[model samples]
Target: MEIATPMATDDRARFETLLSRHRGIVLKIAASYAWHAEDRADLTQDIATQLWRAFPGYDPSRPFPTWMYRIALNVAIGHVRRHAPHSRLTVPFDEALHDTADDLTNDRDGLDRMRLLQRFISDQQPLDRALLLLYLEERSSREMSEVLGIGESNVTTKINRLKQRLRDYAAAAGHD
Candidate 1:
């Protein structure tokens, strides 16, 4: 059997592949939570930076996407906690998202609601955010639990609580 040799160039290439494949997921997840364009941009950059730092530790034996999610989500939650604009107040907009090439002009207020929901979701822990993202992605509970290393019942309970929290938050925010 031949032994494997670790190379920085190969590592960089693998990390870039990870970045390109998951940038959308990271940006969107960050976008939803950061809401404000500037904050979202910062958060996305933070995620990318974290990924770069964590890339060296990545295990070739493990599935890359799940590992990527863990790091990305952790960076996102840390960003919200460390650099979040105003905890108890809503940000007018996240400056970063509009920089993306999506045609969001038609549904302005709807985007606002999405921003609100993102902030609300950002309030949860990183693991919880991952779970919520998995749910919103229409992932099966088993898959979510597996991804987050939680029991199935735990996933169910958390998801229910998340929905209720969103409902209550929407009510509080004057959204129907």
Candidate 2:
């Protein structure tokens, strides 16, 4: 093991601060990819470890979330690919059940739509899922391109296609 120097300590402090500030990105990505809470926690930890390993190459001038997202998405995609054979396309019930509704019948439509959307998302390929997540996050095309390492035009084209597919999915589910 290498000895910790003053510069290393400073870098550690900086990484901790940045990670804390953007911890939601990690959690969101993890939740999107992992079906269970334990898996999400493990994925989150894996992402944090990868981020720390890559921190030395991080450019302070660039936005941290973009860089963090690049690493996190890559990790999550890889995790999904590796576990594909064993992976179940299950959405966490908490995601759809978290919101309180006094009138259950009134909210049934909303909950149905949410479940349909979640199922559609979970059925998508890893890259498609990442694109959908970034799109839903309202990330700009340029930012999505940078994070996904695709061209801006490619990001736009993929977004259009995904939107159409989502529309079809919803229509087929009788949500419209």
Candidate 3:
């Protein structure tokens, strides 16, 4: 067995502190991607494990959330790809809405709006889902591009397209 040095212990403590502070990021990503509570829990655990494994390689000069988002998005996308076939991207919108509605205590109108948004997101492709998540999080275009491995112009273009799509969906759904 290897002995833990003081420096190693310090690093571990620092990592834990950062992880705790940023745990919401992991949770939100998991919840957006995983339909079931059990799947969300598993995804959260997987994200934590990946974050810890990647901590040694993390660059201090960069913003921590950006780095964390990159890893979390990658893990979430991978989980989707591995567990879900491309042809069956998600469960039916009504079923998903009912499942999620039971857990939300918001007003009926708010819940209905949220359910509509969720259905729109679920209908998107994986990359679009990631883009939408970052957009909703209000990440900068530069940050989004960095995390998504795409050009800034492409990010802007996609964001514009997604906004239009969402607007159209809302209008069609009589939420306009």
> For every model shown, what is its TM-score relative to the native structure?
0.65, 0.89, 0.85
Q: Is candidate 1 or candidate 3 better by lDDT?
A: 3
Worst 10 residues of 3 by lDDT: 86-95
Which of the two candidates, 1 or 2, achieves a greater lDDT against the reference?
Answer: 2
lDDT of 2 by residue, 5-72 (tens): 99999999999999999998998889888888888888999999999999999999999999999999
Model 3 misplaced stretches (Cα beyond 4 Å): 86-108
Q: On TM-score, who's better, 2 or 3?
A: 2
TM-score of 3: 0.85
Local error of candidate 2 at residue 52 (angstroms): 0.3
**Which ranges in model 1 have alpha carbons more than 4 Å from their true place?**
1-6, 84-129, 146-149, 164-176
lDDT of 3 by residue, 8-124 (tens): 898799899998998989988887777777788899999999999999899989999999999998998898898886444342345545767767645888887887787888888
What is the per-residue lDDT of model 1 for residues 1-176, given as tens digits with 9 covering 90 to 100?
66556686678787888789767778666765565566677778888888898887888787776677677766766665665456622233345445531655447787777777667765776567678787888877876766677899999999999889899989899886
